[model samples]
Target: MFNRRKFIKTGAASASLLLLDKQSFAEILPRQKTGKEQFPIVISTWDFGVYANKEAWKTLSKGGRALDAIEAGARVPEELDITNGTVGRTGTPDRDGHVTLDSCIMDEFGNCGSVAAMENIAHPISVARMVMERTPHVMLVGEGATQFAVEQGMKKEKLLTPKAEKAWKEWLKTAKYSPVMNVENGTNRPGGKYNHDTIGMLAIDAKGNISGGCTTSGMAFKMHGRVGDSPIIGAGLYVDNEVGGATSTGVGEEVIRNVGSFLVVELMRQGLSPEEACKEAVMRIIKKKPENAEKVQVGFLAINKKGEYGAYAIQKGFSYAVCNAEKQDLLISGKSYY
Candidate 1:
């Protein structure tokens, strides 16, 4: 039953919600006495986005700003205590047994920030936002990124939890790199599990401001000092006030090589629907590496300035969560090209 189908049609909607410090929710989406409202949306990658979306919903429900909402959403998994260690403190460490984090943030303005190969700090998304607000630099990395986080009053603490330590020790015995699929939903398999998912969120406030945030611990057992597309501006995430926003998950290499998120956004500007843009980006990756197209997974989630949103993936099981005033918690499985 591997790769049962290539495309599975699903419902479509636009998403994004706004959250700012000391902001409150407003009637951002279209509304009627009994008609459906479709603005103030929040959509993100994977199933865990359900929880993350709920946290963001808290802000949007109160009419908070969009950027602040996404920051709150991105921190859910980063601060979560989990056995999979997908993000933040409990995330799986590198081959050298170091827990590094990667994250990025983008706002309605051209302002953006990122941190890569960071260690000993939790909530890289928050740090990324700080970088966007406090400094002229758009990114910081390795020791420098860590130093900046500490200097910004971020807690300097051990990121590798005891469970992660035990897993790293066990992995050292095998030291084999065999990537796996669908491990994020809970399965015992080799290759990689903790890296099977990411939180790529996009939100729009009442004023039509778009914002995005993406965070991950990166692929499990990766080489030391490796930074993936998660923290890369145009690769893992992109936002434009005039057009829309997009965020990616799955294989960072394929995403980075093709500049996936940016591609999706540009396509939106070129008059393509969010779904079409995402599908085209997936096809571009396949066209470049047809041989490995089915071997790895890459999915893109996008939201436009009008609040329209869509997602597409290279394989089955890629899903996203959407929420707004019309709805609170809904999970939608996107079509795949496997």
Candidate 2:
């Protein structure tokens, strides 16, 4: 149904492997294999989170490093489920009931790549990997990305899932616009600055090497072609071997503006723990008042290379499903970190 080689060719290649500027990969290596070889890898998807922890845990357990495990794990949601609407085969439809998708991947070495406003292609994140490793560019979008996919022989297929179609059909019956918390309307009342178009994953390998990636079906009831932070480097996903890796879900725009993922990693680099960095990043966005407001809103999740992790949001409660190297495990860090 999909052109694996065509998809693979979309990426830059030098000597069999997609060349992702070895310099970036070099920054995270010397792959430290800990004595705890049998430990499990963790995967978390909170309240609005998607993807099963087993999807990724299995890959890591098989000796795949964080990046491979994360991508392999993420590909499951991108290919099978429809509820997530942000990653996988069935995605949330736009106001018109058409599905568009976006995705990104970042390696611990700081190499980042993405694709956005995509339609027809099932695995945009894999396409994004091609852009990062095959081409000199970090992103490709819309028809351009599709054309590239086609040129490389990637197949085009229907992206809408039955469940998402049902959702749009139902929403159409009500036509009620929910008053989402907007980041732009900081002074008066908060409104949603960005549509939620993201599902993210962060992984640390047994050696402590790290990687992160995000994918989305775009925002629910969004404009037909709107793209969000899920496909932006440093915005949707970020990783640093010296620090850690992070990815965000909910409201892509605020995440982009805050440079959410990178900010968390930087905080960790500055001595804040993984959880502390995540809390600070969310608070930074929430405390922002544009000369007249109450509270800003945003949400994010993070994991440092040390295997520590955390998540935070401006709302009351947020939880992400997680599968770590320890076994089938889940973590819901709760919303409001004291």
Candidate 3:
């Protein structure tokens, strides 16, 4: 909306104003780099991330690769839990009592691997690593994924624990798919935050390399063979050594639709801080379904190349864990639309 007649009347003054406006506009352009981040950091998607961060820190503290730290951390919830196994062995199963798992791993080199709808494995996160290191494929699914896990000498174990099975059975009595609110909080009740979560971990090594891992049992009581966003790269988790890392929790379908994690990193690449990047990603989802934005929950955790991090959620129940040399903080992210 340039006004040529007004500008001509103003003459020299108008020219100086135009030059100043251009200079100000140039200052607002997105920066390509945010500078160096602190080394050896781990962040994850829930209270469980406190434990995951511990595992990730062990490796990072010793100069281990970011990928190793992330894989080790993501496997913790699976190896130690029997009740409400959200990720790894003993996870909640599909509607038909099938305990399928999904996981993905990504390294700083852009190399990645994944498994989807896999069954009977206790450590889908480890199996996913094996896929990344031992196979030529970027992803494996169903029986094929299981076969690979066994081939890697990973034992097939019943992933459905007594507690998880009990929950599933009780859920079947009603078969209601209602997702509850307050997901950004610390409550672990039925249909709470735990019901729609993944052990999604990200790490930055001492050398500044970044990696991420995400593992889940799919949605609680989802239809058999359902594969959620957890095992899908750029959806559940994404890592870029040059940009940052991001992971998602809550509704997987929404994450997949917007490629949530990837969006966060891309925003970071454009000079947004990790916190603002997460907020922008959440806005993308809200813009997609403004009418239903408050009805479901989705949260994103992001860490920039400089080790700075932040998270945001659609509701108030989204919490995460962060660890560095200072300490581990289990913090609830900022709330949104809901």
TM-score for each of the candidates: 0.87, 0.77, 0.85
In candidate 1, which residue ranges exceed 4 Å CA deviation?
Answer: 1-37, 81-84, 188-194
- Candidate 1 lDDT over 47-71, as tens digits, reads 6676688899888777788899999
Comparing 1 with 2 on lDDT, the higher-scoring candidate is 1
Best by lDDT: 1
Ranking the candidates on TM-score from highest down gives 1, 3, 2
The CA lDDT of each predicted structure is: 0.79, 0.63, 0.75
The residue-level lDDT of candidate 1 at 218 comes to 88
Instruction: Give stretches of model 3 more than 4 Å off.
Output: 1-37, 182-194, 329-332
Quote the lDDT for 8 in model 1: 40
The best candidate by TM-score is 1
Clashes of each: 19, 34, 7
lDDT of 2 by residue, 209-260 (tens): 8777888776667877777778887777788988877777666667777898
How far residue 86's Cα lies from its native spot in candidate 1, in Å, is 1.2
Question: How far off is model 3, as Cα RMSD?
Answer: 14.2
User: Clashing residue pairs in candidate 3, if any?
Assistant: 37-306, 89-122, 90-159, 183-317, 184-317, 184-318, 185-317
- The 10 consecutive residues of candidate 1 with the worst lDDT sum are 14-23
